[model samples]
Target: MMTSKNLLELFTQTRSDSEKICQPLQTEDYVVQPIVDVSPPKWHLGHTTWFFEEFLLAPNFPGYQRFHEQYAYVFNSYYESIGKRVVRTDRGNLSRPSVQEVYEYRKHVTKLMQELISKHWNKDWNPVLEIGIHHEKQHQELLLTDIKYILGNNPLQPIYGAVSNEVLIENSEREFIEIKDGIYHIGHNSESFCYDNELPRHRVFLEPYAISSTLVTNGEWLEFMDDGGYSNTLLWHTEGWDWVKKNDIISPMYWFKNENGIWSQYLLSGSQAIDPKAAVTHISYYEAFAYAQWKGLRLPTEFEWEVAQSKINHGNRWEWTESAYLPYPNYQKPDGALGEYNGKFMVNQKVLRGSSIATPANHARLTYRNFFHAPLRWQFTSLRLAKSL
Candidate 1:
């Protein structure tokens, strides 16, 4: 249990971090959603604030006035039990509730949250408050990705900002970290913070497998493309092949050939020559799988990935796995609206392990399971190779 003072400090820092990430955006930059996969920056701001208001404030704080009563209809994402909400696809289309109003909404919720935490501590509400902070951090990542898409796709290809001071130096070389075949315990066994999906720690058997020590890089992907990886349908799943043909995809998102026949990738810091050393990102599950197949290797199963996690380098990109996003044995959703968070999204998605550069500090864990539909790759998704020995 967190003390009142500790919780208040955490709340303040997490809330400030969200705003810090949004500081680079211009007013107009907050409202445009270039693609359905990306929500407008303003919606993320409002929705995260609404999370605390709906879940914590209304239930706990007496006489808590809603900043905007109708905001719930626009911000409640995929919570079927939480009354009606704006459809996911239509979020970008909204221009009302102006950006300023959303900031005001955030301020209102933050003030109430401060009041709640400043009072004597309630052990019961502490966990919910922690979850809300982490939830906002998750949106912080989405905000960066959505902003990348919005800016990267424009004809002008504007840079959102300069690269952070801490540069990501590439791994010196890739190696295969060997994991011996055995029964292994997986999932969250720690008493610390973890999502429900990572709970109910379970056991699984695995064959001896070797996972790459580092992520596949842009230069490596260039080899696959040079060898006609995309045009070769046999290297891809049937549905993936259909998706490729449908979308006319040839390379990773944000990559293009230059006038000198060189390739470069567009990023928040603007277009730069594809770095051979840095991890390749913005790839779909299909693309990751296809790349593995092209190399006569495979993506690791989630269990295998977990077992080999500490043995390899990670936290640079979300790595696609061969595992489907599913419930563990004896999994149970928490009661009420919190239950709706991860349980409902279990079907028809692939699991990606590890955090990305865009992930917030202390937001991801080794057991964290990030999921997305196989065809969507707008996030900072990447891959590695594994093989049964």
Candidate 2:
């Protein structure tokens, strides 16, 4: 547990980080939602603020007043227990709240939160507050990805930031690390902050399996494409094949062929030559599955993924897995609105492990489970190959 003062500092920093992510955006950049999976930048700013107000401030703080009574209906996301919310598809159409008003809403909520912590601290409230901070960090990543989609999808091809020349690793050798068959303990086991879905640490049996030492690179994916990976339906699942045909997806999202007949990818900075050595990213679960099938390999089950995580490179991009998102044995949701957080979304979603480059450094953990629908490809998602021995 963190001291109230330390938590306060953390709270302040977490809130400020969201604003920092938006610094590069023009006012116009904050309002467009190119797709339903992406939320407007300004809406992200308000929705995160609204989380604290709705969860922490209204119930716990004395004399807490809402910045706007109707903001709840506008910002609520997927919490049916909270109240009705604006439909997701229409989020981009909301312009009346205005960016300036949303900033004020954040300030109003943040001030009360800080004041409540200073005057009165409750141990019970600590977990709720921690979840809110982590939730904002989740949106911080979304803010950047959404911003990229907003700009990347634009015909003008505007730049969001300068090309980041990060020296990740010089060695890109491909090797498979072998894990012997055994029962391994998986899921979050610590007392530290973790989402409920990662809890109830359980045992899972695994057969001998070998996992790639590194992520699949753009060069490797291109080879799959060169060999007509897209046209071959046998490599894809039934739903995945339909998705491929319906969307006409030939390569990863944001990939394009220039008039000069060269492949390039859009980045936050601008469109640039695809660095073949960099880990291939922005792929959906369907694509990752097909790529694994093409190589005569398989994606690791979540248990296999957790077992081999320490030996492989992660946090460069979110690695999709073959496992479905489901509750562990004897899993139960807590007794209130907080229970609604992770438990409800455990169906109809595929599990993704690891983290992305856009993920906040403090936010990534070995036990973290990120999930998305198989067809959603707008996030910074990637893949690694694995197979049972």
| Residues 1-389, model 1: lDDT tens digits | 56778779888888888888889888998889777789999999999999999998988887887887899999999888989999998998889999998888988899889988887348888789888988998999998888888999988888788756212456467788888999999999876788999989999999999999888878889999999999999999999999999999999998998878788888788787887766788999999999999999999999999998888888878899999999999999999989998999999999999888889987889999999999988888889899999
Q: For each candidate, how many residue pairs have backbone atoms clashing (under 3 Å)?
A: 0, 0
Task: List clashing residue pairs in candidate 1.
Answer: none
Model 1 stretches astray by more than 4 angstroms: 164-169
Instruction: Output the TM-score of candidate 1.
Output: 0.97
TM-scores, all candidates, are: 0.97, 0.97
Off by over 4 Å in 2: 163-170
RMSD of each: 1.4, 1.3
Instruction: In model 2, state the lDDT of residue 171.
Output: 72
TM-score of 2: 0.97
